[model samples]
Target: MEVIISNYPEELTFPQEYIDNVKAAAEKVGELYDVANGEVSVTLTNNEYIHTLNKQYRGIDRPTDVLSFALNESEEPEIEGEPEVDVLGDLVISVERAEEQAADFGHSVRREMAFLTVHGMLHLLGYDHMEEADRIEMEEEQRYVMEQLGISRDDAKEKKAPKAEPQQPEADKKAKHKSGFIAVIGRPNVGKSTLVNTLIGQKIAIMSDKPQTTRNRIMCVLTEPDAQIVFLDTPGIHKPKHKLGEYMVKAAEGTLKEVDAILFVVDATQKLGPGEMYILERLQATKRPVILVVNKIDLIEREKALPIIAHYTSKYSFAGVVPISAREKMNLDGLLDEVKSYLPEGPQYYPEDMITDQPERLIVAELVREKALHLTRDEIPHAIAVDVDEMTTRPNDDVYIRATIYVERDSQKGIIIGAKGSMLREIGALARTDIQNLLGSRVFLDLWVKVRKDWRDRDGILRNFGFGDER
Candidate 1:
């Protein structure tokens, strides 16, 4: 028997041992059925793509653990004369679903993959489980094959235990390093950016009391000696009142498809509301590993936090629950450990020295906007955007930057400029200090204020201000 495996999702990789296990399982099934010569193809894909395949082929609108398309059962032409080998139908397994189930079952993903492969092979070999009796028989066969491969449920659980002695080689230890992308997402002003900064030990994303502070997706990378966790700090998901609001929500939701895990940050002081519920439903649909992070634990008592944890646990089955104060940097190590367990074995996406992928100009613009958010009234922060028009360096001197702060109305513009331009000067001074620190040089700053009426509602102006359609 021959097994061919292909990975459709870049985040997932099938080790040679897994492939060999699948081949052995296929051959064992064939020997049991008196057909030793056979071949099977396995395609590993994510939930979104598998959802489409499920809808198209089985008329099911949701993703499942596995799908088997038996060629023998199809209406295609059958070859004449004696066939050289039996070509069993293809098997499509959702790697995302496999990871989730493995975590839930307290087993390694290799066990889950082998189980699904055996289940699909049974389907290909004319096994039907529509009836109770047939289902038992098929399950029995599955357990027997898995036991033969030394992959029983007990064996998988034993693999999770730590050995008393460290017998692994240095090369094998290095090869076990894991790396993947994680999305930190939540409702507006839930401390998403603060949590990201705390995790990475750097301030790459701007933070403010105002909602929608993050307008674009910012990627911050945390590289440890053994793992690299690329964190995508997304705009908070909220009800859209304008074009900018819509873009923010879309940006947060879009990260669900591409990330290895999601940190669903929430305000521990606030009660669970419809906004959280909306985000939870979306997370459930992705079938990805979601770690519920109740941020700002410093603001609430431990007794009160228990109820909040219970409330969320009752609502959704999160892979892990962590309580931390992003402002105070409390229990963040536990959060990182939870995140690291879900990431797959892979190479680093960015260099170890690099903390963020954001351009310097964009970071500077966001810094200016952060100052504006901090100083202005509640009504002004959401309606404001800063664009760095020019940034240049003089030889052995200082970094010069000119930026325009856009407001939605003339009144708002007046507030930003302030009496005798005091507000604009203050924003520029604070931003200049941060910019200087970032560039490690002296800085000269020029600031201007402009009004782009209803800019958030206008797509053309939004695009011009860097809120493009691409999420």
Candidate 2:
């Protein structure tokens, strides 16, 4: 089998080993199907571009890690002349989605990419999972091909084992260490980010009082002497007002499948509404432990918080209920203890020094947006998004960064710019301080406000701004 690979979004870089893995998986698929020879194409891209394709072809309108366009299927137009060789369809894989899934599944991205490639190849050979028998057959074939290629789930686990440093004592190695992922989810303005930051003991996820302040699923690592918890701070779930909101809801819901535990955060002061009820209904379907966290207890009396906890407890069988103030960092230790008790014994997923899995560029962009959310009023915060266009460091000078702040309307643009560009300057200055602290260097930030009219509703514009399906 001949596998042709192309990297889309030109900016992404993949190692030679990744390309080799895909080729090997494709060849294994061909061998399994007894094909004399075949051809396949793999395109590597980000979530936004693949999400567009998924919506266009599959009509699901969400970003998936891998999509198969099989030529053997009737979806392809036929030509009159016979072909000299069999041509399998094209496979489009999202590198970003692969990374996210790899981390969630506790494996290497190479393994994830290889698995996706084999799955796509099987699909190209007319394998599907629409029915039980077909699903079993396809899964069996996928496992057989992956095992032949030395890329089974166990292989991935072995590949992901952490390397020992200067070495710990035998006693330390014998000690049981727990590790697992916990997802923090709730409706908008429920203090989810604040709770995650409190648990991680760092400012990894950007925070603001504005609704939907967090647009992406931010992962933060908390490594302790006995346990390591990877906390996924997802965007607050809300009703879909635009394409972005729909993506956020999907991103939050997607975490339910991959996490070992779920933290259902809710504002203690607010009455139990449809949003919390909606989340409760979803949580009922998952077998994993769900911990009901009634946040903002500092604002409400103990008497008030009791009913809130009782209300949620009556609805579902939560593993535990803890009322605390994420802002005040109250009773967080209890919450952490509860979380740790549920985690099974496992190896550390990330290095201790690492605070978050997000790239520096994404952190900088979020910082910029955090400032915008705090400074703007009304609907401006929801209409705004920041993209880091450039970030470079000089040999003997400050690091320079150019970022664009996108809004949905001309009037909102004027609000962001302010009179004589005062608001823009303020946003830049505030954002620069955080950027400088984050990079540990002096920084120069250039702020530009551009109007991308109703970008939250347009798929193409959302992709350009980096608000892919992952967000």
Candidate 3:
């Protein structure tokens, strides 16, 4: 099937990997049904743009997580076709709400955006979570697909550390509640998401070397006997070039303001650069205590970590200077202890088992994007977006999904599709494997390619592409 993606709202920001995830999920679903060749349209928009859509389409008058427009209104899945491609209709997402929700939930915008896409696609395919039974079924399917795609529920808890001597009575009876926001900030390409994932001990944020890979504030909650820390993995702080860039910067900056502590992650192996300085300046403005985290220490010698710590300590009076490698998971416990010290006593924000607040569609989107980003290199990484148009379960127990991969230009489109459609095929294959792993059942995935002609810079396009909301 062919999936088309377009953006509205003039200046919405999102990672290119999200688009790939949608396409991958669709192909996976298509494979399960043994069907091919369908058409799906997806739009990325901001809150203002989506709000208009919500008001005009559903009469809700307020922006929601997502809205699906299914041209094929029939309740049954379309028959596998010949001359005409199945017209599954359009999926729209709110970039603004995606960003806000990411921060509120403590995960990346990519995950939130992808989750919305998947959720909308499921709705288009007739999956509803209105009742308890329906909700359980849907939740299972969502989690199944997510886990198959390598996304896990954050609710999984870890075994408590054994005490050396005896547990304190007060510490044992009272479940320690550590609830507060910890913002991780740095320039693009610094392992901020990796650090957050390491701290939370789950893959909540999509990790990539691509600069500015994270477009929203992703929340990952970590709980213990006495504490719960909500870690916000934000877009890398960088100079703005487009409206989306401005929004990303705003997301990172805003998170810093609202959080209880800031974990300023930096590449310990590299010398301090302009990007590091830029983030440091912002960190200075925050009244909350800032912990200078020199991540990637595993790449350096043990002696090297000390000098790096000394250099940063000289530059700023950080609340604490911590050196650890997020990739190697070194010194994460120490970092968590420091983060807990900054959190004030507050009511538990989530259940003890809860980890992240993002929905399944967003996580699915991120998984697709991660595959794409890993497969493609350089600037091409930034110009892509994925949209899941439809996700359905047939009577036989197999799942079918339809999605689109969007680009700003025809050349970029050509590159994505590759010669003889080889590149597109490779991306689809890679995505399907992940999706199959996620769903635990056969996935019939259908993929399509189209050019949206600079949709990233166009407001109407952004709104149509699900980049913003109505307000």
Candidate 4:
């Protein structure tokens, strides 16, 4: 069956790995059932738009969980023109709702969304939970698929302990010594999050071999002996050309003023030039001790690394010069040791158990952005912005998400839509996979696209897209 999955109103915000899981689940289920071909349309959307859809299609007065529109009434979807691809009708999900449900379910937004995508896909395959037996079967399949994708409901899945001695006797509970900030900074695509993951010893910050995938400052904490290090994983620094660019740069610069120490990450394999120099200029102004972290040493020779390090050292009087690979987890301890030495004494900023300070909904929106950044190529990154319009969870334990994908122009919209909606279908297919991963259970993601006429330049559009206003 030709499964035509599309995100409504906008592209989804999630990771690539999550998207892969959705595709794998589809192939596996289709193969097991001996279904030769099937076509399902999955769209990502926001609350207002999905509310419109719910009102128009289902005659429901309010936005509900996932709404399934089944074209095959009697049996499984039949292969229409070609017996190889069966048309399985359409499934619309609200990303905004999926994010809300994820928070309610106490899981990563990616997990919650993946669950939703799987649930919707099953509906397209004629799997319904209206009956108790069918509901159990569907739920079991969801869990089975999640297991295959290496996703866990356990909290330990994303956590790390600081290397420190056992707790010492303390006179006061709040007087315990522990608190510092490790600000991660770099030009866009320098593997800052990879370094954070290495330090945290877990996948807290989603990593991909893509540039500008991280849009916000994600703080992951590590409590060491007499100190709790808050690792601030900032967005990749780059020239500001759009509203998002300006905001991302502001987020990066803001950390410089607040943090105790800074980890200036650089792609070791690439030549150090203007971008590196521009960042260096910013570091020179910061009073905090700067640790020059030359990442991706795995891609270079020992001899080559020395010269690169030498060249950078000559350019700036960095507090410390360290060479290591973030992805390979090399020389991380030494880097952490340097960071510890620079930390100022203070109480723990967050409880020892807390890893991040970002809200679940914001992360969910970021996850959708991550998915879109990877799926769309070239200048599409600048053209795309995801807005969580409506999110709600039902008493029966299902999530509803609605998201909007905003583009700058009508031509760009056409580019996103693709030939006879094939491109849009591809975007949905890619986004649904991750949405399912984030939501964990059944999620209804409704996606849509709208042209705002150079939103990057318009103040109102920027404000609506969560920019133009001081945070």
TM-score of each predicted structure versus truth? 0.64, 0.64, 0.62, 0.59
- lDDT by residue for model 2 (21-60), tens: 7888888888878764888889989889998997676444
Candidate 4, residue 127: lDDT? 79
Candidate 4 segments exceeding 4 Å error: 1-176, 201-211, 224-226, 419-426, 429-440, 469-471
Count of residue pairs whose backbone atoms collide, per candidate: 0, 0, 81, 76
Candidate 3 C-alpha lDDT tens digits along 258-314: 789888888887898787787777777669898988888888888888888888888
Better of 2 and 4 by TM-score: 2
Instruction: Give the Cα error of residue 394 in candidate 3, in Å.
Output: 3.1
TM-score, structure 1 vs. true: 0.64
Clashing pairs in 1: none
**Residue 190's lDDT in candidate 1:** 97
List ranges where model 2 is wrong by over 4 Å: 1-175, 379-381
Stretches > 4 Å off in candidate 3: 1-175, 379-381, 436-441, 464-466, 469-471
Model 4 per-residue lDDT tens digits across residues 1-471: 444555555454544544554465555555555564665666666667778886665444555445567675456654568445555666676766665544444455566556666666677677755433565687777677667656665423212122233554665323234368788999888899888878876455766567766767787888654677988899888888877778888888888888888889998899998998989888888888888999999998888998998899999998999998877888988887788788776533442334566544555566566666566667475667778788777776566777777788888787777788776667666665665555554566676777877877777877776665463
**Of candidates 3 and 2, the better by TM-score:** 2
> Which 10 successive residues of model 3 have the least lDDT summed?
155-164
